[model samples]
Target: MQLARIHHLLQVAILLAVMVLSIWLIGDVLMVVFAATLIAVILHNLAAMVERRTRLPYWLALSLVVVVLLAAIGGLGWSSGPAIAEQATRLRIALTTQAHSLRGQLNASTMGRTVLDYLPQSLGGNQAGGGDNGMGSRIAGSMTGVLSSAFGAAGTLAVILIAGLYFALSPALYVNGLLRLIPPGHRPAARTLLLVAGRTLWAWTAGQALDMLVVGILSGVGLWFIGVPLALALGVVAGMANFIPYIGAFIGAVPAILLGLSQGTREGLLVMALYAAIQFFEGNVMAPLIQRHAVQMPPGLTILSQTVFGTILGLPGLVLASPLTAALLAMMDRATPPLDEEDRV
Candidate 1:
């Protein structure tokens, strides 16, 4: 019996090792597939809505929705292309100028010089290969890095979008395939869990959209009222960044504050104060309101999810963490049995 138990333990260990190895090997593919699934979920819901209202076939409705969405995007881009391009250019230049000014100020102060001296040479753009044109070279290298990252991301996004279309086209096929992988005894529970997860994800997505919209509008109006340059661009960035929750707020605020600082210390302080007020209202009021109707994730758990997933898959993992957590929670709730009266007592 002892030998048998030891053998079983060894087998379990080996199985776990294999699982870990598999995950390590295919982590990128897994993330891509998961991202594709998220897109499919959104597309499926949209298609369902169209089908229900028009009494049309699912595929046809989905096709029409896709076309209309593409056309709408194209129309919007056509009308606002030049203005948006100009705003983006201005925002970039302003940020770069502000950064240089801040650096100059830092270099000019004795205390700042001390702090700067302690920093890495690479950060100062004076490392090897930096040469006489260190700043220019650094800028070139940074732009190259940005372009490469963007190019890679665009390719991955293209793959995800194409895969999403396929998944949305025949969701039942994939669902049934997944069911087939489950043991017969557990299929029913699996199906129920899937339903729960789907519903939870939908609620989370809808609420998140509402949250982003409110943040974007409020931020834009606030910045505009303060007479901040590139207010619209900053507001839009803030809104998009808010899609990531806690960390995103700070990420979005940095740019706006930097621009404010470029104007004056008073303006910077005002911007900071405004951001604080907005985030406070969002966290205390809007978040709770949204959570009550949508999904409730513990703050610590949300942060842990973001950290772990971000460590594993970078930005995509970080952005998907909250939604995935909600889905997992919903599945867990569905899977768990209610406490018996005796157990409760």
Candidate 2:
């Protein structure tokens, strides 16, 4: 029996090692698959709503939901592109001018002079008559890489859309199929857990969408009120970045502050304060209330699980962590035997 146990442990170790290697090898494809799964979950709810409201068939309702989502995304991108581009150009020019002024200011400072003395000879005080051509070249290279990645992402999104459509149309077929793999007695429990997970995911999706809209509108309006250029662009960025939870708010703030600096220190301070306030309200008020009503998670465990899974899985892990944790918690609640009041006493 001990030898059999040792063999089982060795087999489990080998399987885990293989799983890790496979994940590393196909990380990009896995990301696309995970994205498709999340979209399918969201689309399932939308399709169900449409089916109930109208007399449309399941396929037709699913198609309509997909089409509407695609149209909304396309419209937003098309409408915002020109303005975002113009803002980006203005911001770039401002950054260049700011960098030159900053270089001069730093050079005049005591610490700057001390640092310059220790700098490598190649990058030292070599100021050409023209602007920072090296910086320009680096920026161009980065843009090219970004464009390439975007094209790759577009292809991945197409796959995800197709997969999501199929999943949304007849999700019961998928659920029934999965349930068949479990023991007969456990199937009911499995169904319950699945329902819990779906409900939790839907609630999370609704809350996140609302949060993004609020943050984007507030940031854009605040920036405009403060007379900062590119307010809309900055707002859009903040809204999208908010999808990543804790880290995203700070990342979104950097560009806003830099743009504010172009106007003056006062503008920068105002923008910073506004963003800070928005985040505070969203975190303290919105998140707690929504999560409490929708899907409750233990605070300390949620943060720790996010950190651990995020380290292992990167951005996708971070994005899916909350829902995944909620699902696990739901399963535990269902599977554990309840204690009788007598036993508790």
- After superposition on all C-alphas, the RMSD of every candidate to the true structure, in Å, is 5.7, 7.4
> Which stretches in model 2 have alpha-carbon errors above 4 Å?
1-28, 88-151, 183-185, 298-303, 337-345
In candidate 1, position 320 carries an lDDT of 86
TM-score of each: 0.83, 0.73
Clashing pairs in 1: none
Residue 62's C-alpha lDDT in candidate 2? 82
Which parts of model 1 are misplaced by more than 4 Å? 1-20, 110-151, 338-345
Q: What is the per-residue lDDT of model 1 for residues 160-273, given as tens digits with 9 covering 90 to 100? A: 899999999999899899999988998999998887877887888888888888888888889888988888888888888898889889988989999998888888988899
Kindly list the per-residue Cα lDDT of model 2 for residues 1-345, writing each as its tens digit: 999999989988998899787655554456566567678889988888999999798788888988898899789779977888788787668766776776677689988867766664444543433345665444333333322366565765687888877777778898899899988997998899888777777777777788888888999999999999888878888998787566678867878887898789999899889999999988898888777767767767777777765655555566667667776787777778989989896
Best-fitting candidate, scored by TM-score: 1
Clashing pairs for model 2 are none
Model 2 scores what on Cα lDDT? Answer: 0.76
